[model samples]
Target: MKPDFNAMTRKELRAYILEHRDDTEAISVIVEKIKADPNIHWYKPEDTDRFPEIFAEHQKCREDARRNQENQ
Candidate 1:
């Protein structure tokens, strides 16, 4: 199930990824959603109120997939 970014907390989002980190395709879908929103992922030093661990993990998944495809 996709975590609704508007409704879920950062901690919850992180936990969601921890459970589903292996599913890169699903994460990609969510990443696209976040990217489309823009405001949901404004990262900066002042970003104490927002957490981006899920976003980071999604990026890492995409990068790993690219590397794996290249290696193949």
Candidate 2:
């Protein structure tokens, strides 16, 4: 008998995938559940005011690294 994927938690589903790599149906169910979950956000949007300052700092660091590389 096939296990009910819908009843499994994300961790259980992941373990099931590792154990049953050939089960495409189980894989599909996991993908669909994750997509349907509203709380499964990968990245939260940062505050815009802080974001620009952080991005500018990152850009400056990258530019400095590139200049140092070119000088070497």
Candidate 3:
């Protein structure tokens, strides 16, 4: 039986995708989730005024990741 991708957490889905690279459905779900995440920001070249905001967001994401890893 196929696993229910919707029921899986992002971390679980990531692990599943790595182990089953051929599962395009799982990949699609993860891609959609990422696209819908509010914390994610896509920077554009024309948004010059927003560079600082974008950079700060990126830095915050990196720091949060580091903290999560350290806690783990």
Candidate 4:
């Protein structure tokens, strides 16, 4: 289940994602939620302008991390 992004603060959102980071489906859901809410995660003056680009970069980083992971 996705967190109520509309009702959650940025800190709460981060904690929610961090706790469920291992859950791929859950992570995707929350990420989409943040993407849909343009106002969310909007911290710092620059983030408002750089959010889309930064989010794309971060997504790529996560995908690269996943691809490089080895079963332990």
Runs of candidate 3 with Cα error greater than 4 angstroms are 45-53, 60-72
Error of 4 at 54 (Å): 0.4
Q: Give the lDDT of residue 18 in candidate 2.
A: 98
lDDT of each: 0.66, 0.84, 0.90, 0.68
Is 1 or 2 the stronger prediction by TM-score?
A: 2
Off by over 4 Å in 1: 1-14, 40-72
Q: What is the C-alpha lDDT profile of model 2 across 1-72, one tens digit per residue?
A: 979998998899999999999999899999999988774433446555577776787688779879999999
Candidates ranked by lDDT, best first? 3, 2, 4, 1
lDDT of 1: 0.66
- Which one wins by TM-score: 2 or 4? 2
TM-score-best of 1 and 3:
3
Which parts of model 2 are misplaced by more than 4 Å?
Answer: 42-72
Q: Which ten residues in a row have the lowest lDDT in candidate 2?
A: 39-48
Per-residue lDDT tens digits of candidate 4, residues 1-72? 665665776577678768877657556656777677654444588677888998897788777768878533
Backbone clash tally (model 2)? 0
Clashing pairs in 2: none
- Writing each residue's lDDT as its tens digit, candidate 1 over 14-35 gives 5677798886755665676667
> What is the lDDT, from 0 to 100, of the residue 60 in candidate 1?
85
Question: Which 10 consecutive positions of candidate 4 have the poorest summed lDDT?
Answer: 34-43
- lDDT comparison, 1 vs 4, better candidate: 4
Q: What is the TM-score of candidate 4?
A: 0.35
